[model samples]
Target: MCGIVGAIAERNVTGILVEGLKRLEYRGYDSSGIAVLDSGAIHRVRRVGRVAAMEEAALAENTNGQLGIGHTRWATHGGVTEPNAHPHVSGELIAVVHNGIIENHDHKRDELKGQGYAFTSQTDTEVIAHLVHRHYVQDQDLFAAVQRAVKELEGAYAIAVIARDNPDLLVVARMGCPLLIGVGEGENFVASDVSAVLSSTRRVMYLEEGDVARITRESVQVFDGTGAAVERKLHLSDVSLASLELGPYSHFMQKEIHEQPRALSDTIEQILAQGFGASLFDGDASILQGVKSVQIIACGTSFYAGSVARYWVESLTGLPCAVEIASEYRYREAVASPDNLIVTISQSGETLDTMEALKYAKSLGQNRTLSICNVRESALPRFSAAVFYTKAGAEIGVASTKAFTTQLVALFALTVTLAKLNGRLTPEAEAGYLDALRHLPGSVQHALNLEPQIKAWSDRFAAKDHALFLGRGVHYPIAMEGALKLKEITYIHAEAYPAGELKHGPLALVDENMPVVVIAPNDALLEKVKSNMQEVRARGGEIFVFADLDSHFHDSEGVHVIRTPRHVGILSPIVHAVPVQLLAYHTALSRGTDVDKPRNLAKSVTVE
Candidate 1:
């Protein structure tokens, strides 16, 4: 993932660009840089570290300009070095900041080198700058030059370009990645995310695929790929700056962990207010009428959320369901049918693999597609026929907490809606499920109340280098998510398995030094999971059990029990997720790791 910001303003925009990069720090980057056009020349500064370091250097050098672009790079094409940072310049004529990968960069670089264009960095983005410069020399128009340059390039990319000769304009384009324009009175801005420009403007225009835009201080002109001018609807963004701020909590992860109650309540209440029909999604309930089977595709935390939905859809509607990782699903030759509802889940709708997977399914005639996403303006919602937006506002943490739980709430709603449409859910059962959904916020609050006890176990967990998470049935995916959170934040090697699968192979790794975390809810599979716990105990494995209040589990030597709130049956996974997130947070804290921005990971994976 990467962040891009560009601005053309009446006043000096150096501070604006730096502040915008700071707002995007949550995306995770290894280096940062900025380029500004000042008096018919391009001034550039790049640093191979945090934005703070680049900002300090920019301020010390008094780098100020009325037109500029900035970038925070997550290092895909090249290693972390100053020369590899963004705002890559070519012949002092063009400077570019890009968000996505350029697949044909190597070939493009070879061709550009043949033309006698010197290269300074080993980045796919540097090729963009050189290509733009090559075209600019012929047309002498920044907008037209960028348009001509992109025609030769291939891959997912959102780029912002600035020219030394054309100081009054900035050109931006988007293909598979996301790019938006922020509108102001005497200023215009472009960014990969709304948060980066939230302070300067609340109104924005999101560019569609293959659309290129010429932005100036006074006006914005958007043109499609065919050199024809077009209009893009401007939206008044509802995201407040306060939602992005860390108020009482020490970290964004901690704040997001506690914000789950409100997030679930808002998502559920919005649906309840809408009266829970097909109208809850983008297309009405008729989209579900012909759906015979469900195929869910996603990546990372969203994939696990889809995995949980697999259990719900199969049990509730008797519809066979399958969940696949988006990256793998996009490449494999899978069967697609019109009756198979293709569902894609993503916290940010711009996840490249998931977006491509949805497109691949649509290309194969699986047109009954739906997207569950957090950002209403993201690409997935716009591409899919139906969409359900999760109300987990502004998840800043790289390891998702509120976003994942809110996704579960949204997926559950989708499942029940499908069940009702298929006549599988009786009115009584629907009412009961609705009641449980209404009480979910309170149950999540009860789960958060156990944080102190979870924190008490963090020191011990931090001392260990490996952990094993176990659960049964629906909670098995929850165990996988827990293990993912732990390893993602704490840098511990962790693995998860269905409690019953322990004897297949993983039981051989159990010992006194291994900490086995169990999800022990008092469901139908509780006895089986308990039997699995005894197997770990028989191997002298140190067991840490997060049990339901009525699970009949007690603490003993080598077997530690921390009882969570009463289980809510089908909705237990959402409740059980909070404690695991807290455990990851506390353990990462004890280990002195960055809880919000983990190493080698970006919050939104825009590239493959």
Candidate 2:
């Protein structure tokens, strides 16, 4: 995903656009560029590296304009070069910065070339500038030109356009990608993320699919797909700039790991503040009463969170639950039932595969949809029938930490609420569950305290080439998340298997060099998991156990133990996920890898 920001202000906005791009650099850092409409002409500058370089180039060129747009790209359509950077210009009339892909770009490029429009870069985004130029030549209106050009394209996109004639206006549009307008006094801003414009404005309007906005210094007018004027509410962003800064930590990942206590508390407190009698689902409770089963569709870390929810939903609600990888779920001819509840989880809320999967489910007449997500105004929440906002704040790290744990908190709340509505949970059990949930913040803080010990264990993993993570029952998904974090950040080969699945195939890869990291929560199958650890130890596999302090699993020659503070049964996944994240962060730090950006990774997977 690329980060885009646009600002139309009375004063020169070169520094404003540069600062916004810096805030959004976490979304993409491969290349950066800026375009401005100044003195009846469009000025553009591009760089192949960080936003700092792009800012330097802009300053050297003395780029300045009241209306402008900027982009930090992760490079999908072309190589990471100055030519492939965003703010592509068509002639000297139009400039465009885009995020997401244009699926029909090749066909459009061929047609545009037939019309004698020359292309400069290998990006699908270049077609937009030329297409807009074509429309502008016909109608001579920039706003109408953007609408006419978008109708000719396909796939996801959020774009900002600036034209030489319209020096005071910034036209923006979104289709299946995130875009929002930030409201400021006598000035306005647009960006792919709220954090990008937080320094300028706190009030924002999230644009829906096919929504276009014409932003000027004094006014913002939004129009829907049918050419009808639409009204959008402005929400005050609670995120402060301080939350985005690395105050006392070495990295954003480390800051976010410590922020877990507050993030989890905020998510759970949203429920606890409503009191135990309030409905956890923000919508009607009747929707839960008729649910017979559930289908969870997600990708990456969110999928693992859904996998953890599968164990809880099946056990607590007495319902069949299935988890599907979103990309695969959209392609297959899976049966959809009216009695099934479809749940989608995503941190960014604009994940392409998960969004497409939910749309596919809706196409099959499945309307009972719910979203567990961090952004309240994101596509997933807007499309779902019920919304559970995680309130985890901004997670800028490429490898997720707080978002995963907060998703589990929301999913756990959903599971318990459904259980109560289904007549499966007793009054006493409901009270106990709520009590435990109220203490989730304290429990997460206790887990954060174990970071020192986990960091010590990370030293053993820093030098390893391969590792294995093991768990049983509900914690099996936790093990998968653990292995995923390690592999994602450290570049280490890692695998996760259910303790029972070790003998089936994976035992052969174990040896003295391979570290076996086991999630030994003291659940009912602790004995079986302990025996599974013995199997690994018997094979000269060094065992690194992250077990409950009460599990009585002690350290010996080949076995290393890192005890976590005991937590409530259902919330164990949230607590256990903390140590796993720490281990990965510390291991990555030990290996001197970039924990925030990671290699070849972006924060949001807006493109498929």
* Best of the candidates, TM-score: 1
lDDT of 1 by residue, 350-439 (tens): 999999999999999888889999997799999888999889999998999999999998899999988888888888898888889989
lDDT of 2 by residue, 254-290 (tens): 9898899889888888677764332666664456777
Stretches off by above 4 angstroms in model 2 are 275-278
Q: For model 2, what is the C-alpha lDDT against the true structure?
A: 0.90
What's the lDDT for all of these models? 0.92, 0.90
Predicted model with the maximum lDDT: 1
TM-score of each: 0.99, 0.97
Error of 2 at 17 (Å): 0.8
Residue 421 of candidate 1: its Cα lDDT? Answer: 89
